[model samples]
Target: MSDHQKTEGDQSATQDSMRPESPEAAAHPRRLKSFVIRSGRKTAGQQAAYDTLWPKLGLDPGTPLRDSRSPGRESAPLVIEVGFGMGQSLAEMALAAPETDFVGIEVHPPGVGSLCLQIQTSEIGNIRIYQHDAVEVFEGCVDDASVDRIQVYFPDPWHKKRHHKRRLIQPEFTAMLAAKLKPGGLLHLATDWEHYAHHMYDVLAAEPTLENLAEDKFVERPEWRPETKFERRGQKLGHGVYDLLFRKR
Candidate 1:
């Protein structure tokens, strides 16, 4: 892969390899991670951002957010976005909604650092981050019936049938995600892969509590979600994007 591609994917590698949640989830990771965890060092800007911005913007694994609710900023809509690679769109959303508290969960170190840099450059204060497995963060850190919206955009398709099991939008994981939502809380997902979009729809449709927001089960990309350079590239390549929105019932 090109260095640019290696350092910054369109989406974060937030896939969970292990199916079950355990305390050792962090200790033992990446047996069959859905996306390639590209190996590299953080850029100078990213490293510098880590030094200057991480203390205020970073969140530790298993930090209980339900009780604290972002260090004295309570009563704001709590939005958790999984796999926010490079954080361009996530930062835009945070800037757009100053009244909302956004918590981004990404598994890549470069992504974490890059987003820290975005937070600094954008000068947005409503965003915090967790540089850890998305599944583990959802399982342990976020409390049930607490989140207002959850976003998972363009997770790896795992296109091969044999590797489909590693795809992040499995039944078990969907249920766990739905459990974290408050009643009427929304879950928004988008993907360029057709089959993977359907797979996501099937998994989320099966969840007992989530009601599909669209009558057709897919919706147009909302204005709140900014198109990333990666997504624009995909669009130019004639890729069709599908968005699925569901709300806890």
Candidate 2:
């Protein structure tokens, strides 16, 4: 098996150990998972970076963030991004905003490995990573009302009607995310799928604690977010991208 395949198998084994125990527990409506582990070969450079850089850049998913120090400056605002695929845009944002600290949550091993490489090569100090489920990390590790901003960009559309339940922008998760943000903290989301964009807008709008940042239900993409390769590809295919920004009220 390739290194990536082995890594994915190990992660799945670990997840299995933590699965609900009893048949009743299992039958109690399993949480809708937003991702599937897809194995890809990890490059030697990525593996090396994961080995060397992870000690300094990785965060334990079970550890509470209240005890952790913010990268660079203690007073720096903490920005957390969910599912930062390949970490390209995340690395760019961290580089551009050196005064702000960033926390990225992703489950894919190759993406984690690639981000480790980026952190090492760029000598980036303002970002940390958690290679685990974002929902679990938020609930178990992050302190209430502690985050300054939350970003979710280009999440899986889960386009099929039967798969809509698996989409990440659900109402319960939205409320939980809003509660994690301090009053006035921002939640920013973007998507190339119009259906998913509308879904996100409806979910966020339903959260009474969050106030929309745009006059319209959707907002134009902000200047701070770097144009990602996936986004460029979507544009080339004549896809419309929508951004939504909301603040905790």
Q: What lDDT score belongs to each candidate, Candidate 1 first?
A: 0.80, 0.82
Q: Report the C-alpha lDDT of model 2 over 22-64, residue by residue, as the tens digit.
A: 8885478678554557767568999999999888888997789
Root mean square deviation (Cα) for candidate 2: 5.7
Model 1, 1-249: lDDT tens per residue?
A: 111342233333224323545769658754533245666667999999988988877787857776546656777899999888778888999999999999987766787788888888878899988877777788778889989999988877766674576677888789888999999999999888899899999999999999999989799998888887777888899988899999999
**Which 10 consecutive residues of model 2 have the lowest summed lDDT?**
1-10
Q: How does model 1 score by TM-score?
A: 0.85
TM-score list, all predictions: 0.85, 0.87
List pairs with backbone clashes in candidate 1: none
Model 2, runs deviating above 4 Å: 1-27, 70-72
- Best-fitting candidate, measured by lDDT? 2
* Candidate 1 accuracy as lDDT: 0.80
Residue 90 in candidate 2 has what lDDT? 90
Q: What is the Cα-based TM-score of model 2?
A: 0.87
